[model samples]
Target chain A: MSETPTPDGSPSTWSEDRLHRWLAEQSWPATLAGSRGHDAAVLETFAGRPVLCTDQCIEGVHFELGAGGRAAGRKAVLRTLSDLAATAAVPFAVTLGVMAPRSIEGVPLEAWLRAAITGAHDAATEHGAELVAGDLAMVEGPIALAVTALGHTSSGTVPVGRDRAQPGQLVLLSGPVGGSLPSDRHLEPLPRIEAGVAIAAAGATAMMDVSDGLAWDLYRLARASGVTVRLETERIQPHPDAEDAAASSGRTPLDHGLHDGEDHELIATIAAEDWAAFRREGAASGWHVIGTVEAMDRSAGHLQLRSPEGHSAWLPGAGRGWDYGGGE
Target chain B: MSETPTPDGSPSTWSEDRLHRWLAEQSWPATLAGSRGHDAAVLETFAGRPVLCTDQCIEGVHFELGAGGRAAGRKAVLRTLSDLAATAAVPFAVTLGVMAPRSIEGVPLEAWLRAAITGAHDAATEHGAELVAGDLAMVEGPIALAVTALGHTSSGTVPVGRDRAQPGQLVLLSGPVGGSLPSDRHLEPLPRIEAGVAIAAAGATAMMDVSDGLAWDLYRLARASGVTVRLETERIQPHPDAEDAAASSGRTPLDHGLHDGEDHELIATIAAEDWAAFRREGAASGWHVIGTVEAMDRSAGHLQLRSPEGHSAWLPGAGRGWDYGGGE
Candidate 1:
């Protein structure tokens, strides 16, 4: 019996061996082989010394489909790397679950997947890690990629967390604190791994990657650490590029620096005594200290923003951040 | 700022913690701990060996939106466990990536997530595994869960893939084979883990889960192994309940036996001499011998069905396993 016809019955139109041949032609680095592209990888030690994190990059929420394949791929890997950076964990390996639209087919689909994986692999390689096990499936509509990365922090690594800061510690911002929107800074966040590693190695008190904006994320840190945070508006460092976008958009760059998420830089606190040496050690590589941590009423888990005149800018507010708590 | 109201949100809506608490309240045995509820569990070995498999279950493709919280959760974990069963890998621990729609507020969403986690925990516990790491995200739409489970077969544990069968080998069915419509068997198809472990231990030559129906998947195995497979029409065992459904649908139960996917049972080949012992070992437990491997020929990659009257059943050939290979 004849099988379903392909209109003209052209055997030349389809080649199942395409994917295999393409994969074979590509050269892969030796270091990445053990943990990347294989069905499974054996980890030497994942029990007590591992660092694990999960991040979701949704279709419209985390990224725009219009970003095209290359950027989509880049964004997918960066989102997860940003998480790893938050913990000051060195890169290791990652697993991804990708969902694509039903309308995608043939070369375009393969190319998209290849680009995403390659982008991730290249980035991981740059970070001294690899891309490992991943799952691919077709879905009905928008594209979504879920990534999980596992890493190991060498012994004595300070586990960077929002809750590790102590009262009376000096609040610090690692670098220029803006450039989150219009600049596409949110789409392509630098994981700040180097800064994190340096700080942790130098005995930093507590740390976290600035994702949900400096103002808001700092609030989370202060709340978790049971401290009241005071911010000097004049000293807040806004990314120079953010100011350009803000000028054109009729908004203040400080607003962008304070409210925009995805900066992916480190926001940390160190004991006031350690601040000078810490800032000196960090500044050799361009890290900066933006402010100080002062004693506030314990009952006030509040974030007070001060203008140049030392006047309060607002009342207790949930500073601008990405609200993933769903609808009202 | 006030959040916009959605139908799924109200004062009585669910909270995340409460939902997690409810998930902990499921009725499950203690041995299921490694499998049930953790971010991700680490298993030492599966049946004394190492094996790894991951399954991602999306909302629309894997389960209906109306499927109760508990059922949805159970199905998600089962889907992953089933994959492990197919590979004959003893399940160890599971890492979950759960994406929930944000529209529904409060308890229902929490309840659903909790239920899903619990279901996964139940399956893990049943399979003697642990839940260790998890990634959670709020998405724009329907809920989906991805479970990545790790199992350790003994160091010597090698997957009995379908392509390794040889001529003269006995083709065996692990249990009653059929009734794979999504409505009935999709949610609760038995994972042939026990059968898989037993078959592997008994020295199976090649194996695979009987998804995408017997005839279609058999074709794939034959192609992979470079062998011709012959199936006895009279000998092919139909599911016990296939006849009733076939009657109602005005189709033959044999059709159901040959076409329905999602059974998640193991279909494997055993050496000729080991056939009798294998059958004897599983007979009380429901394994059956359905066919034999034949010499490779021009049509070696095809599945030839020998009807009772020595005729061929060329009616619409059964076998496109569900390929949800697009975006959503």
Candidate 2:
């Protein structure tokens, strides 16, 4: 047996044990053990239900080396953490699977692996989660990373799903959206974990993270909940960078707000009667009311945008955005 | 904004939704939901410690497409499930992250994805685990699959770890090991979950799955447990295919048994006093005593093989086997 050639035509010399030891040295939660040097990791789950999610970050797909390995690693973990936030679950532990190329940007594969692990560790620690276990493989392919986030429901709470919205519920966004790519917000945006828990506690109905643009994700929510979501165009607030992006790209800020993906913000639907209390508590967190749920009308489309002048238009391809095969 | 070209110089046309619908149609446990089109999957833990592990199957590194996508998929899940067996943890659910190439074996990307998902579902369901959540990404690289297996301890049972072995304990194997690669046994070996639980219940001190050859994996167990393991060469039983492999390759069956990786068999250390009882109950399941653990001697090797003629030799490069970068 000999060393395999990497995609960049370099020899792969990193051993699996070398990578395992690097991961074991990182700070992990006390509840995580039996992972390093063992077959699997053991973790203690709280008395509530468990929430699990997995997301992948592929080079030249989710990111390129030009953005740095740290950003790619952080985005991998953040994507899964965003799902935990949408479910209103408390973070527990994460296991990473990395398929590394031989070399990245003139740096050895070891450096790239270290940077990625460090970024994942920092992000997990910041979110009260632990990096418990990981596996690494070198291949003659683009670098790819997979993060599996495990979480649990807190006491007296239940995980929120995307199919629980009811008619007459108001749709809300945790913060501004759009222009995420230009601002690098997709890699650094905060997961609304606390806000998600607060909303779930105050009786929010359906909820999800807006990773694939507001128009696409909202339509998914509407379809899952069997309801129609009508957005008030005048009430939408674009991210601060949206105007600059729109000016340079010949598109309106509203267009970017509706089409730009990877915002990593939480969105939920709250009953009209519960909106007052939710708003009173969530105002400091930048929760904004943007739309309302109504009875489904197949002719009107699942998602519709209405202007202040009383003109309504269907959002074309409302549930389509940023697919991996169809690159962004 | 357009479909990207795959590594094999073909266009990727598989959509995330198309793969999701295919997975959702598979037979899964009743408890798995909110996974097909949701951000995260929610599962109920059975009031026990949770076991988590992630393993990767990269195309070219783990298996080439020449082996077929179904074999690749089955191997991916089986690898993680083998870890679960080593821990004696009852499996609950599995989440698959697939990064697909444009095409495989002259088939469309969608066909490759469907075959892989179907194979994963079949293997997981056969082992009494649900295929709960999955993420699909089409990348300009070789196919990569990551299987994150989540399991839980049954009531009154605890997860077995590699650090619990003690000096004077006997080492045992679940079945013969050798010539796995040539026989294609590496891709389809049975994971010894029931046998592992039995051994644990009968008081196994330490345990691990023998994936990277008996010599390498035994050394790992010894190092983790702070002991030295000695094996009897005359007592070692090679698999039925090992003789043919050795005859064709001009090596001894013992050589193959010592170095051939990916056996997927369970190896455990048990107290000498408990061995009799374990053997009485586990013999029907093919458990065989193979060696003994002793105090570590830095001057000597962690693993030593002794022949009946009073000759001994240290296994060369113990714990170094089948690294992805090194190429097996």
Winner by DockQ? 2
Per-residue CA lDDT of model 2 for B1-328, tens digit only, reads: 3655566654456777656555545556467434345677777667567888899987776787777778888889988899999998877888899987654545557766777877787788889887777788877688888999988766566567887778898888888889998988777868788888788888886899988888878877877777788887777789887887998999899888877888888899888878888666645377788888889866556777777766454543433355454432
Q: lDDT scores for all predictions?
A: 0.62, 0.78
Residues B1-328, candidate 1: write the lDDT tens digits. 3544335553233333334334445553243212223222212222343334555677776787677666676766676676667556666666677777654643456556666777776767777765655666666556778776665454455556666778898788877666666346677766777887677667776777776677767776776677877877677777866676687877688877877777777778888667677656654265667788888756434467777677342212333333332111
Error of 2 at A202 (Å): 1.6
Model 2 misplaced regions, further than 4 Å: A1-13, A26-29, A33-35, A155-158, A280-284, A309-320, B1-12, B24-29, B33-36, B281-284, B309-320
DockQ score of each predicted structure, in the order shown: 0.17, 0.51
- Candidate 2, residues A1-328, lDDT tens digits: the string is 3655566654445656766655556556456645355788877656667788899988786787777778888988988898889988877888899887655545556656778877887898899988777788877778888999988777666556787778888998888889988877777768788888788888887899998888878877887777888988878898887887998999889889877888878889888767798667644376778999989977667787888767454553423354554432
Reference-based lDDT, residue B45, model 2: 60
